[model samples]
Target chain A: MIKRRKFSEALFKALGLSALVLAVGTLVLLFGALLIDGVGRLDWQFLTSFPSRHASQAGILPAVVGSTLVMLVTAFVGIPIGVAAAIYLEEYARRTWLTELIEVTVTNLAGVPSIIFGLLALGLFVYMLGLGSSILTAGLTLALLILPVVIVTTREAIRAIPVQIREAAFALGATRWQTVADHVLPYSASGILTGIILALSRAIGETAPIVTVGALTFIAFLPPSPITDQPPYLSFEWLMSPFTVMPIQMFGWVSRPGEDFAANAAAAGLLLVGMTLAMNGLAIYVRYRMRKRVSW
Target chain B: MARPVDGPYIDSAGRGDWPKPLKAETCELSFYYGTRLVLKRVSVPIAECNITALIGPSGCGKSTFLRCFNRMHDLYPGTRYEGAIVLYPDSRNILDREVDPIEVRMRLAMVFQKPNPFPKSVYENVAYGLRVRGVKDRRAIDEKVEQALRSAALWEEVKDRLSALGTSLSGGQQQRLCIARALATDPELLLLDEPTSALDPIATASIEELLQDLKRRVTILIVTHNMQQAARISDWTAFMYLGELVEFGPTKRLFTTPAKKQTEDYITGRFG
Candidate 1:
């Protein structure tokens, strides 16, 4: 019996060690490939200049701006609504059949393919709403794609908070809004921010949805002012303008016949990777700081 | 200083006669979780400036009964209560269908078995209740937080590290910090549900001492399984069995000469 138990324990340790080695090995292999293939072409001109017809002249400036703009707008539009929905569902909503159904639907929505969301965005924002295939439309589509993830993550974070914290606030004569605003929000802030950053990262990498929604393949022009003059500066007509993002631009370059276009695509891929890494790194740092600040 | 009285005594009315008037009153109170009945009809008068200890074996609905005072049960799903709980002699029934629980909760605060402090600096955790009430002035918040911490008997230990996270405190200190957080809101009544059950003997002793000091300012209702704890801190005591109030009166009398045989059996450690 002792021999069997010892053998099983050794076997379990071996399996765990093998799993860890496999994960690390896969990560190293991928990073090695990225460095070998893409590192040589990475330079200042490649990052700061617009794409060119010539192989050597092409730069990723427009794509970088496009991705940044789309991501910023997506964060601005999606986070508040997603967090509010999560709070209402977790803290305030009555657990009737309707709420349960809504909860289930949200969970399922998080698992849906990003490409479908792009198609929906094309039909709704571009066609029906007449916004066209601009940065605004792409951002809106990406927001929809990531809204369920943000909501689910925020809900999980909120749920991680003990009921005792809320009870403590309520006992202190804090109103419902007050308790949530004061105790629940501050306590869950790190987790909620982490969820938002993660959602934004996911949105940043999404090419399928934006592609289906018709993000511009090449646009040399900067985005028009967010406000336009047809009616007044605050008019909704500003949203109809054309726009492009990095992923679509990279896809355009990669699919072309020219070797120069492929090189430019690799360079743009490197830039995109750098940007996403920076965002994720910032998120990790913020999470660490918050963990320290709220260390109970 | 007055000589403290001891031993159990009863008036001519058999047992369960209160020396003081009711500070809060519950009428025809019963609670249900989904289809399960947790509390039968229970009516009890809670006296002001005193500790009322609710004692029963596990699952006797003592904690559930305590939560009803501040409507903490409302946080749970499918929890329905049929009753009127009134604070003082006021006509406003706290359990009125139209009354907002948030407002009722502001007047009555609660502490739980486990200490739960917000994941914020110690200063911020105490200031949170005050801030929610719109006290934005930094100086005022500082003053109130200090006062609260002192009142909870924690200021001396935590004074230097007011900026520290609340969780960094030891278990006893964390419970005291929770008390400070509750006290910061200036609540009239405080509800504690097994607030010391998670603590070691030393921590428990400190909390018990703090409870004795706290009763002078805030009316306290504590639910405890410890008969000795109840005897130590409470001015009044209620013994419950199977969701029913078996007996309640002065703590000494309830412990020594319970009117009901069930209360006598439970208190004497004969049976629970």
Candidate 2:
């Protein structure tokens, strides 16, 4: 009976180990295929030039610039709003049904599909708000998509900070706002940062919402730069310009029927994956540093 | 000094001990955690610049009563405080609706059971109270930080590591850092809820000694499970049981002689 029990335990452990290996194997295969199809296509000119009808000449400069611009706005619009909402829900909100309702709604919102968010953005931001099919609209659309994730992560981080920390602050005669700003915010900053980056990572690869928001499929010129070619360089004109992000560009390429277009699309996929991994890596690194520094 | 009241003294103010000028006094204070009442009508006067200890068994509401002084009980919802905790010098009822808990806390600081140091530099942790109180002058904050750290007896050990994070210190050092953080605000009263419960014997002794010196500077009220520590450090000992103040008097008298049978039984370790 003991021999049978030991054999059953080992079999279950082996099965669990194989499941993990299978998941990693799938990821490795996907990366291998992307590398084989895309590596030969990567070059400085491909990075710098605008897209062309010929697949070899087609570059992703406009999409790259667009994604960068839209992401800047996404981070700018999302972080403060997400962090504030989290702080309100966690710290200030009363133990009432109203707070519970809002909390449950937010948790549910995180599970909503990207396409539904796209449709909502199409109605609210593009048409009703009259923002036009611009980078501003696309950024705002993606920002909405990631808000739930950001809020969830921020709330979790703030919650992870022990209650005694707040008690210590309050006992010092610090005001509620002071306690949050001083101890709560500073202590949970790394967690907040990790969440924001993860949100940004998710936002970076989103295609449907931006597409539904009416991003341009083919663009020859860059959006107006925030930094001017002259003095008094800062400008807001780029916000209203037409844009196409990296995922939408890859989607456009992959949908067309040709080997060359598919290969170029694969290359763009590689770049996009690289960008996402960089963001996730940074989040992990920040969390690791924070863990090393702060024990209690 | 007011003569030490003996044997379950419930109403000294009615007995005409009114003009003693207390630092603060809770008059028939009742506390509720949700629907369950945690503290019954507890009326205790805290003398200015003296150590008062509240002792009881686990869940006996000693900590709950201590939390009422600095409004620590107000941190969560479903917990209610009824009656008044009136502060002298200002003569304001802290439990009044208009009286801000923030302002009350500035005068009545608290040190918790576990040492919770903020994840910042030791200097920043100590300077935090003053900074939040709007003391922006760099020189003034630095001076106060040093003085507060010195007062907590942590200056010599942590002077070189002022820029180090508070969590990097030992548990005892961290508790002292919290005390310095409280002291940085220059509060009139310090409420300690089991400040040394997590420490080793030597660390506990140091903190108890620090309490004796600290009482000379600010009024202190501590809730402790260690009966001997209460006896050793506190001038006034208030023994509580089942949410009621069973007995209260001088520490020496309370420990040596029998006032209430429950207090005698608990102190003698017959039962908690």
Q: Count the backbone clashes (under 3 Å) in each candidate.
A: 3, 0
Candidate 2: count the clashes.
0
Please report how far candidate 2 places residue A221 from its true position, in Å.
Answer: 1.7
Model 2: residues >4 Å from true position, as ranges? A229-232, B1-7, B10-21
Best by TM-score: 2
The CA lDDT at B268 in model 2 is 98
lDDT of 1 by residue, B11-110 (tens): 3354437547667866667899999988887766688999999999999999999989888887777899987787875656888899887778877778
Candidate 1 residue-wise lDDT, A99-198, digit = tens: 9999999999999989989888888998899888877898788889889999999999889877767777777667768778877787788889988998
Two-chain complex of model 2, DockQ on C-alpha atoms against the true structure: 0.76
- Distance (Å) between predicted and true CA of B115, model 2? 0.9
Predictions' DockQ, in order: 0.57, 0.76
Model 1 vs. true fold: TM: 0.88
Global lDDT of each candidate: 0.82, 0.88
